[model samples]
Target chain A: MIARLLMSLTAVLIVASVLWRDPAAPVAQPHPRFVKLDKHGNPLSPWQGPWSCVLDTTQQLVWEVKTDSENIHDGYWTYSWYLSGDPRTSDRARGEANLGDCYFETSRCDTQDLINRTRQAALCGLTQWRLPSAQELSSLVQAPARPGHAHIAQDFFPHMKHGDYWSADHSQPLSGHYRRFKQGALAVNFHTGKQYSLPYRNAAFVLLVADLPSEHHSSRTSGVTHQPTTGN
Target chain B: MRKATFVFLHMLTIVLVICSLFTGLRFSLLTQDWLKFLSALLPQGNLYFWHIGSASLLSALAAGYLLLSLWRPYRSSPSHYHLWVNRFGYLIILGLLSSGWLLWLGRFVAIAQPLHFYSLWLLLIYLLMHGWAYFIQHGKYVLSALLPKQPDKHSIAAVISVTAGGLLLYSAAQHSAETLTVASLAPEEFIEIDGLGDESHWQRAPVYTIETHGGINFDDGRSTIQVQALANSQESYFLVRWTDSSMSTNHLPLLKTQAGWKIQQNGFYEFDERTFYEDKLAVMLSHSCEVGADNTAQLGNRPLDGKPPNWHGKGFHASMDGKIRDLWHWKAVRTNDMYLADDNFFGPPAIAQQGQRRYTAGYQPDGKESGAYVMNWQWYKPGLVTPKRLPDQSNAHLSVLPWFGSTPYTAENDDFAPGSTLSSILYRSNRFEGDRADVRARGTWDNGVWTLELVRKHYTGSEHDVPLTNGTCMWFSAFDHAQVGHTRHMRPAILRYPL
Candidate 1:
């Protein structure tokens, strides 16, 4: 009797399953990317060294490559664009301690001064290493597949920081724009793909960009001057 | 008459067969084209509703049949192997249906997805066995009985009814398929500034050290950890050796059986798994964090000069805060067998209204129902006493859901085999839903020393978690046999480099 009942039940389920099956459905296909357009930035040519600097062809800029040890403090390093100033002077909050003073042969220098001092050594065989403008620095960012990390073209710039990096464009004495490796929180830089105007004194990762001859170069550099004065 | 009934059942079941076929279990031969064709011919009104409704009815009917088979005379019919197969088969169907309902509700995602998925395979196998048995026993006679002499009006009506019922069950089953904190501790141990001294290769060790809260006397019967910190470029290892008088593994449980309702008072007279709490260790981490404005998540005052406070905070955060803190809690019972610990943390709740309940974290195995919780039924029921039994006697986990008035485990129903005794150490099950925790730990005990290794990924990418760095500060706590009893220190220990 039990067998009879189950057999009948199974029979009914079979019929139900068939009725619901999708026969004419198209073959499954993967979802398309958001855009079909493809473009790879011009790779840096005339490049040199084990610490190879990249020439971003798309933006016509030279980048000083960063490694885990390139600018290390203990193991990882952090630095401010400037040491201290008020919110109006530099967009940084007061009471935050300075992580370090200056790394160059000089006694004291802001992130800009450090960059300027290092360029004299011609470490990358390129003496024009200047703090990159916020836009130029942002171009190197590829927002990592995972959060709390920076998306650098690691093959060229090894050991990109997951922390914020300093930008050369300073709107106030206290604040300079920085592009963080990871998104920030409230009362702090929050977005990953944009510039976070931080205090010049606040420590961050640094990546210098050297100008290259190109039509887009002028437009990109001049645009930084027009950006509204926003403090970090 | 039996033949007539069988014929009618066959006619009604024809619709079910169609529904089952539509499921495309066999190579999914029926495609969307077939579905489009059927939808045009079918009376469509929320197929999901009708399908689930019919399946529920079918499931209940099958359950009733099982209960009937268990009745006096039929219960003794051990010869009916097919009956037993069908009984268990229907039970699986019921489970599948229940999981389907839970999935629809968007509750217990961890448990329902797997249960709903596997139960389908189990049901299909049993049904095939059911069909094979009928063919084997009744043979040609069974086929003949299902075919009536002519299609009478009653048979035609039964067939139509079955089709409509099939649609309901189809919708019901599809409905089921659709879905799919930080604590601070202060541990104090004053080790040689160079973690390794006396030419012990501690050249690059950290310069600072930490002292425990109150400097609890090791001889005061409180546990003390002789700690050493070591870190190279790759990983950090903390060797914590603690002196424990006894090795305890008794976790509190509720046993219900035939004797009576008895609660084993933990450690009152003897070690009882139902009452004694398991020994535990917890670690929390934070990076560049100040307790957000909310008192719920504060770091107190750790001087930038690397100085800790005079007292250590105990238990959970005194207040709930919006900030994130990564916590790794080590429980002996859950992970010892699997070599995994309950990894948990404080984070934003999946739902908004849950409030602090969302503040809690736990583990339900991936695609499995097991979970771990420090607080259990012991919190509510108090003042019950249980007689001491052989500590080595084994205890079994019951499948009781508790609220359904199921028989609780008692000494009688929880029987001991005659002349045979098994160790009554501890046992657990995988039956939980929602809020899975993340953390892993391994611990070992010998003589009176407990050695534990707490490991977590260096980068968890969790906002609540602090990155493990040389400058990272941590607190510690140790608990012995006493339930909720933990020993902690006042100051946070800096993770100094091992010289």
Candidate 2:
């Protein structure tokens, strides 16, 4: 009788865990739209994420904004695009993701953990999430960008830093692409929104992007208004 | 009532109770005095209402369980110990609730603090006692309560799956922690304190990388703090660098807005924890020489026997008696621009002077200048110590946005006006002395990196400061944005002065 009770309880717990979606997951779905970019590099009209996924109305990709405020600002959590001995294949990322805690359970959550566990968790309700390609990542900065303000669209992405982010595309195992943000009280070392190559061992921030979503984009309003660029 | 339903509620209650206990422990740990590290992840002063709310529910349930026992009585012939332990556990739970409620309401912290703290353990003890009683009531079959008579692949698969999941989480933390060696060599040339870290002497210095341990909830663990050190015959120069997504020098200030005396956030005022403290760093040097007979260099505060009812000061950290530890705190706001890190030492308990309060430590420049600068904001201010502001003192505007004036803080911008104690210390104090701001630090938050150059005389000839030697071990903690009673560190890196 006791055995039956314990097994029954464990089964109920497992079922309950999967059925509930984490409320922190992004609410927006993904779709493709082709549009023009302002000279500052911002899309002509602001892109909106129903939850936290930014739909590049123009690029048609869904990008996960580092919604975790602590992660968004934490410099140490940054990672290289590739982990050593990683299968280094896109298909492996597409397989069924076994889930685990990325924050509390681990000693460190690197790019691999982000891909496997965070991806498995189906953040923003998509599982095929992976690193942005070189060009895809480069599109974030609009240089001759204002000093101190994010070169990227603040409307969609807030709490952004000028720190470089890792891009999946790599020339050699050692070298990978990174997208830069404007730095300084003034954008002094501003690179006019360009991509640079560096060693894969170098840590860069992770911002996941997914291909077109199964569900059509949401028309639901996010309630946040866009602030126009004040930068020169 | 169904047995399964009864078990489920009890089981869920147990899980929440355990969670509450841990959160309660964390809440208590962060309240102590000896902390030197800052948490960039958990915003300080975030009240854990969930912890209290959960504990309350647990207490209520435990009460209900005990009352139910009274209604039915333990009829089974299980040991009398089980019957008694369960009752005692419920009583302890009630005790926890009462004390926790008192702690949450902020009353009699001295009494409520310890009672609520220890009650969690007492309650757990009851659980252990009750566990044995449970086995007595159920017999040996309870050992494999969830197992089938025959082991099956499903069970093996389940075990393997759980083990693999643990490994996945464990693998993230598998990197070997390297012992970074800090080589101390005399610089070939006099080091300049300019923001630029490009001097030839600096270029030749040994670079050691240290990793931050806690606050992984926000970080990827890939960020490395670069530490480079070089000492000359006259002075020692240490340069530390790290990457931050953004820079913040915004120290929350006491503001007098249209509504009246207001500050941006009340964390600093309410609890010493700060959400808007300037991005800062600290270096703690504990002398290995003459380490107490106990062989410990770091000293703790003297234990209080009687609650000095009139104790008007914030207490000292872990110091038990006598010797103090050396601390060089670099604040991006209050002390940095002044070319001075807060030269603070922690050791002796606060000595009540006829007119002032003093914590006796070695290096302080005598004239009542040691310890933290802020009154550390406890309700114990002796009198009306309002700061006076003078808006007309100067037109220095704060450069950053979110605020309009040339400066983020101004003496005149506060409720007390010229009396607003002292506003932003960007402009040097008019009556400063040599010892007032001793250690010189120059750094700028440019782009994503803060390049800091710190220079101090090799020896200040103070009994308090231990002269730098080959085997000095100093702990470093970086605060992205925080202040006061803040202590946390992963591992202390090794720094060796050249023979």
Tens digits of per-residue lDDT, candidate 1, B327-419, equal 555656545444445544443321111101111121112221234222222112333323222222222342112222222234565454433
B394, model 1: CA deviation in Å? 45
Q: What fraction of native interface contacts is shared by candidate 1?
A: 0.01
Candidate DockQ scores, in order: 0.01, 0.01
Q: Which stretches of candidate 1 lie over 4 Å from their true place?
A: A1-76, A79-128, A138-164, A170-204, A210-232, B1-59, B67-499
The weakest ten consecutive residues by lDDT in model 1 chain B span B351-360
DockQ of candidate 2, scored on C-alphas against the true complex (2 decimals) = 0.01
lDDT, candidate 2, A1-232, per-residue tens: 5765575578657756653432121122112232222211223223222234655655667677553222322222555445434465544322111121234334544466676655666655567777777677767665422223345654345445456666666543222222232111111111335555555445556667777453534332223333221100
Candidate 2: regions farther than 4 A off: A1-232, B1-28, B31-188, B214-224, B289-316, B352-387, B392-394, B399-436, B485-487
True contacts kept of each: 0.01, 0.00
Which candidate achieves the best lDDT against the true structure?
Answer: 2
> For model 1, how does the per-residue alpha-carbon lDDT over A119-217 read when each residue is reduced to its tens digit?
665543446666676666766666442223345444345445455677656653332233432222111221355566565456666666666545534
lDDT of 2 by residue, B1-499 (tens): 2233234445646665776775554444444322212111111221243354465456555555455456653344535776688668767777887876554333444465567767977976876577544654565655544223443554344334434543442232221122334445554466678656887766767777654322211132123467788876766778888665557665654444444334444344322334555777777665532211111221222223221111111222423446656667787776665566765554443422111112222223322222223311111222222222233335323311211122322334543443232232223231224343456787777877777888777677654454555555566656666554333332344456666
Please give the C-alpha DockQ score of model 1: 0.01
Residue B141 lDDT (model 1):
84
